[model samples]
Target: MTDIHQDPGAATRQEPGATSRRVIQEFWRLRWVAVAVALVGSFVYWPIIDNFRVSLTHQDIFTGETSPAGLENYRRLTEDPVIGLALWNNLAYAVISVLFQVFGAFLLAAIIEGLGSPRARAFWRAVYFIPSAISTTVTGLLFYFIYQPGMGLMDGVLQGLGLGAWSRVWLGDPDTAIYAIIAMSQWQGFGYAALLFSVAIQKIPAELYDAARMDGAGALRQIWSITLPMTREMTGLMVIITVTGAFQVFNEVMVMTGGGPNNASQVLGTWLYEQGFNQNDMGYAAAIGSLIFAVTMACGLAQLWLNARRRVT
Candidate 1:
């Protein structure tokens, strides 16, 4: 016997099998939603994978045909001087940019964390992070114009300060162009780094700092020996993120220099773009893409390995 409320069909009782059948019917009606999603993915997902397969093969520029050429494209990537330059330049960029980003962001984040009040902390955080919100395209354009030779903003400002000799064509000069790109990347990247550090710092209990102070450690020593050590994992993570971004540098280069000034700022991303689109060397570009993917995975694995080593000790 069942309660009246539980017996939907009831003068007295309703069968559990009948209730289960209704539930199953409802589930069947809703199951179309899942099927539709799967059907949509079925149409698009296979083609994306097939295109990746085709990109690994040679493509005919004139006839628009493709054929498998195995690993020859990868061999060519090693032999090509331009590709070599691009790879070297990109590697350098990753090392230099990550160094700057980690040091600069960590310094700034630490200072912000030390501020006496919560509101002041937030205000400065916003001030520093505002530059990162703008599109890389717009930031590149703005800097490009600023660095434009005689009448540009940077030039004019330097000239007004009676330092006209100091103002050269910033983007046009080979020596200065990659540095200019780094400046832009740093501006965009520091915010995210700061945010990560800030979150980590906030999570660190204030009692830890207080205890360090009680042990006769001055603020500087406390930060150097305590705060920095405590936050090492976060630092490692931020370095990895910054390094990845440096290798993936593209938007600013595309908008500003297009790997110009004689490949002075040429990076792997733009090189890949040129290989796939301009040169129509899709297979080789796929090799480059694969190389980048492998390197990125390696960095992540390396970070994990170091973290595990730290935990073991």
Candidate 2:
């Protein structure tokens, strides 16, 4: 009773209709999910578009006047000395953060991994990670007191060691302010990176290390050959995290310095806050936000591409 020969064209026409019907049914079934996704996407991305629009306009926060300024704000950003200093400070912070938070964590993880007893390993891991568990705001406040001019712990320690000449107001001096902040950040953040590295290192097969040891490789040689190679991916990930965190650094800078001591330690986040809220330069602040978003996205994408390429090879 097949009517194939009777009307072959009829089946072809029905096939397209059937396919379209199925697609419509499927979309209807998942309509709520699609709606939720659209809602979330709009909620997340609308602000970004609005921020860009504001950046292109000269919107007075006080008088509520709005005018198109085109690229004037961006041009002013280029000429702004404070912006340049903030950029440089961000770069320095990234470098120092990578050196201490990422690499330092790797070293600590390696040492902990080499411990003979599981109890000792667990103890040290907890000890190192405890600092990271403390609230960052609390850590900043604690360090603020620790860096206080005369009666702080650092000054006391330096004086006790007969190094009084080296202990002059760590946070007060422009030369040492940023570095002191960097050190505090490292102390709080490195342990987290170390814990992650420790987990990655533990996953690496013990047989690899055992094989190296049988070849008369000492601890240093084993680490160089075995440990480092195994944790390469983790190191890459940590570097990306540290760099992004460095660029977006705000809490510590806000709590400790407020970009003070003549704005010597101004970073993009604090600078954005200063311009946007403090100075009522919302349009310019939006521009700075756009720049920070662009740069962070670019760096993240570049890192992901490089990591993927490295994996492919």
Candidate 3:
């Protein structure tokens, strides 16, 4: 009987020196990635772990208020009615912004995708992306004037067109302030989402389109099936980006509304800023910060889980 160990395939597997050399080569080739990952992790964990420790064990490091808060701050998050309202408002704002930005971006990207010449595509892409080039502070300020009651642009045009009844105090009224801000964020953010889709769409093989056309798929049908399905990974990533960005919105609020008209537009980030900077309630504000961090991390992990599942397929 032939010895199993002496078989040709077994000899190939037993090439010890080759395997060792390959491992060594791979280690050297990938050593920089390991170093980079380690360096990045150190910074990430330092702040997260430190912030968690600080939140749980509040010490006035400067003013001597160190007295193991022991979940007091976290407990306050649930019990404080204002905090609850602010958090609910924040959720509402994020949902509104994400819905508008992602949906608008996807629509715009779809309209422009593969339909334009290279020069025309670049032109519209730049046009859409132009607002994102402007600082959020500047854009907020610009829109602040645009929505002014009578002296401003919209009001001016409305007054000119005898559509005075349609115009309202866009920012002054609580009923419309958050929605207006949502529009501003969407306007600035849509370009980013479109650019991401554009980059991903470019990599899709043109042959796929040719195949779809041969099957007599109309542009809309082709988009629903071929374009969107193939770009599901990109869509998931863009949704995560939109959601995280929505949560972090602060600059526009600071410049235009300042969570004003009696906290009508109070999102979590704005509330945290108001507390920490305005009220000087650093401890309480830090708790809000922690919550924001948690929400962002949850969204990130959800995105990761989705991506992993797609890979498994």
Candidate 1: list runs displaced more than 4 Å: 1-52, 160-163, 311-313
Local lDDT at 85 for model 2: 89
| Residue pairs whose backbone atoms clash in candidate 3 | none
Runs off by more than 4 Å, candidate 2: 1-14, 18-36
TM-score head-to-head 2 vs 3, winner: 2
| Alpha carbon deviation, residue 184, candidate 3 (Å) | 0.7
Write candidate 2's Cα lDDT for 1-313 as tens digits.
8755677576567654788899999989998798787887798678889999999888778899999999988998999899998988888999999998888899999999999999999999999999999988899899998999898988989989999989877787888888888889999998899999999999999999889989999998988888887888888898888888899999888888988789998999999999989988888998999988887777788888877777612
Worst 10 residues of 2 by lDDT: 7-16
Provide the lowest-lDDT 10-residue window in model 3. 58-67
Question: Which residue pairs overlap in candidate 1's backbone?
Answer: none
Order by TM-score, highest first: 2, 3, 1
For each candidate in turn, the TM-score is: 0.80, 0.90, 0.84
Clashes of each: 0, 0, 0
Cα lDDT tens digits for candidate 3, 154-245: 89999899998989989989888877887887788878788778887787788988999999989888888777877778878777877787
What is the TM-score of candidate 1?
Answer: 0.80
Residue pairs of candidate 2 with colliding backbone atoms = none
Choose 1 or 2, whichever is better by lDDT.
2
